[model samples]
Target: MAQHAVPSAAAPDARPATPVRVPVREILPWAIFAFVLAGVLLYFVGAEQGATSVFGGTWIHEFTHDGRHLLGFPCH
Candidate 1:
């Protein structure tokens, strides 16, 4: 009896096989921008959430709880 030949299962490479380069200089500006934006957004969220320091109490927190008086809008 004759034996049949087996086929290989490896695939051919179509890429350069080198890793892509990242530019730190270009990335630095966007990183800083994102950090600053996140900080500002966090501040607003904290303020809305009634965050206070030792120096003083949260005015917005108090105002939100004290009840809002409005001429055209309903108090919530």
Candidate 2:
């Protein structure tokens, strides 16, 4: 009597997975929007006081007071 080899039941599939692609053109507008949004937020938190005030009062500064101190901005 001769012994024969047996195949394993846990063999991997032969199909390959497709890779995902991100195009720069599609992301540029969103990147620019985010940049502008960040700039606006930074302005409100850092420079929304004194002569550069946008709302003509301390409302923005008061609202972002804690954040200013946290980010090390001169609030006083």
Candidate 3:
């Protein structure tokens, strides 16, 4: 008995996938916005009180109190 070769299921004429182009210019603004937003959030969580406070009174500090302690920031 002769052994027969198995044929591949994939088509030979299948086109190769093209690499997708990332629009840097379009994404840059949003990336920058996200970075700034993250920085602001970090500031609020880490240093939104004492001398580094941006807003007057204890409103911002109290609002983010739990977040501050959760993030390991010293609060007294």
All candidates: TM-score = 0.43, 0.76, 0.73
Model-by-model lDDT, in order?
0.53, 0.87, 0.86
For model 2, where is the 10-residue window of minimal lDDT? 6-15
Clashes of each: 0, 0, 0
Q: Where is model 2 more than 4 Å wrong at Cα?
A: 1-12
RMSD of each: 11.5, 6.1, 4.7
Q: Write candidate 2's Cα lDDT for 1-76 as tens digits.
A: 6643643455464355699899999999999999999999999999999988878777888999999999999989
**Positional deviation of 24 in candidate 3, in angstroms?**
1.5
Q: Whole-model lDDT for model 3 versus the true structure? A: 0.86
Q: For model 2, what is the alpha-carbon lDDT of residue 4?
A: 38
Candidate No. with top TM-score? 2
